[model samples]
Target: MTVERRVGNEKIVELLEGVSRSQIIKQLRPVGDASSAQMNGGSDNVVASFKELIKRQDETIATLNHQIKNLTATWLHRKRFVKTLNEGIEAERELAKLKQEMAERCQIENDRKQAEQPHIEHFRSASLPAVAEQWQQYQIAQLPNAEEVVVQQLSAQVKQLEEQLTYGWQSFEVQGASLAQTSAQLVEANRKIHDLEVQLAAAMSNAATVEGARSQIRDELRKQALRMLDAMLRFLDFITLDAVACYTV
Candidate 1:
């Protein structure tokens, strides 16, 4: 058997079929004609490459997950903002309706002098002057000082309602802006993540193809090595058979 001992520890023996001697024996080996020590040290390189690939894949997945989570959070935030705005709008509408009803009732009461009505009986007190009480009490009345007082009260109420509406509008605008900005950010982030994943997948596929080609080349090299070893074994076999035939003759 002709053993090609390139790497010192490796024992590449004859690879004849059904032979007593074993074939190639190597834990790890470099393809090029490098030292055994160099080959042994280089196992770390393959390990490092695999680790890097795994790390990249993990990073890509994590980035994509974070983007998706951020988008979902933004969606929820917008939903809550819209719900709150709707509630505020409904409340404002009810307040406006109440104010309108109150104004209408006051107008109806003032259209005619109805002092004897059951509604105004409790609004007026016995100790107050008739005109003074009438002026101070019913939001609707015909008096010199009544219009100013009514105007002041209505103005205050309207101002308060206006302020509330303004606040609601400002809040809505701010939330809407936040939603728009968040949505845009989410979209951009997702796009970047998607691009990264595509790149990662392509790189991994390329790596796999390269590894496949390398494996095929290695297999062919091993086959050639085996054939060489087989020739060596056949030479030893021919000598043994010739010796046996000569002894028998």
Candidate 2:
């Protein structure tokens, strides 16, 4: 099959003559290294390919219309098939997206529930000590000897709370140290991401420069091959519909 593209004549001829899997891989490597957006440019070659497909589709319809001139049924049948196929594909894609969204929402809810659990336990533990002390102290009997001796419970409670505060400060310091380490890791990760992005951009630019030169040669050869096919058909009156339909020419 002849390839039609917007590239140079001589370069097109050279590449087509020597095309290989490795050569194609060489063309693909740069796209792999490129940014998602820039790789899309390398992938524009795909969109360009679609242009030819669309053109050939038009040619096919023309041939069908010309050959089966009496019946409009075939034309309508082809149109309906293409429409139904496109619609089915679109519906499937939408359904997949909705499923993905629901999965993400469920995951977020699970995480929220997990996070609340720890705080719930902490509150229960804190309340248990105060309630127990209140109940037990009320049961203590008053001292004998006609006068009741009063005990200073509030001072002892205050001292115990101070000890707990000291430990709380210690726990806070340990968490603060962990946060400092995490911050350092985040900074390093950002630096690495930046470096990879820069390298990817450079690789893309280099690949584009190489492809530009290589594509020129491929175009020239494909265009000539197509022209030759057309010329051969013109010289002979036996013009087969296959050339117009399947043949790139």
Candidate 3:
């Protein structure tokens, strides 16, 4: 009876131990499963975070490239505008020189006419004495031949003066036409310069606006990257703690 009672007590202790071990295993199973799920969830979160960061970085790079392209185009346009402005200014200077040359030519022509006037008067004075002598002879003799010779000489002198005046007037008309054409060209150049200036101003304004947008986008990207890094760090910390806890268990 004593041995049998001892055996029955041993069986009861074994059954109790088995029940406690099973209960512990049941509790540990859920914990292990939960830890495993957390690890998997953390891995997924990290991967997603990295992917999102990569996507944002790519977008930022693309934005920077776009901004660079815009800046380059603006710079090229400005260079072209500057070149055009320089060319216009040079053309204006050339026109001014042409006008100065025309003025000098007019002054020279006037001086030449002034120099010739004295000689013309001297010739008229010298010829008048001869003409007076002829006229006196014709009056004294009352001869038709003497009167005819004096009349022919006077008509020739008048014809020569009329020819000189006609040539001077024609030259003046030609010079006037050339000056008018140059004035019209200068006015057109000025109009084109004004248009180019307006275009440059508009381009500068557009560049400023684009730069502002690029800066704003860069700031947003920086903020987003920082947020992603912080979340990744926190996730890593959570995984580390979980690993340590599992090891302890």
Top of the candidates by TM-score: 3
List the candidates' TM-scores in order: 0.29, 0.26, 0.36
What is the Å distance of residue 159 in model 1 from its true position? 64
* Winner by TM-score between candidate 3 and candidate 2: 3
What is candidate 2's local distance difference test score?
A: 0.60
lDDT of 3 by residue, 138-196 (tens): 67567557667768777987887677667555655654575565556556655655655
Count clashing residue pairs per candidate.
0, 9, 0
Candidate 3: what lDDT?
A: 0.65
**Candidate 1 residues 146-177, lDDT tens each?**
77888888899899767766765665566557
- lDDT by residue for model 2 (1-249), tens: 222333445644543454455445555664445354554554465556556666776777677656676456677888899999999999999999999999999999999989998998998899999988776555444334212222455567677767766755665565557556555655665565465556555555776575654454346445555655564454332223323432332
lDDT of each: 0.60, 0.60, 0.65
Alpha-carbon runs more than 4 Å astray in model 2 = 1-138, 143-152, 206-249
Better of 1 and 3 by TM-score: 3
Model 1 RMSD to the real structure?
A: 57.2
For candidate 3, the per-residue lDDT at 227 reads 56
In model 3, how large is the Cα lDDT of residue 199?
A: 56
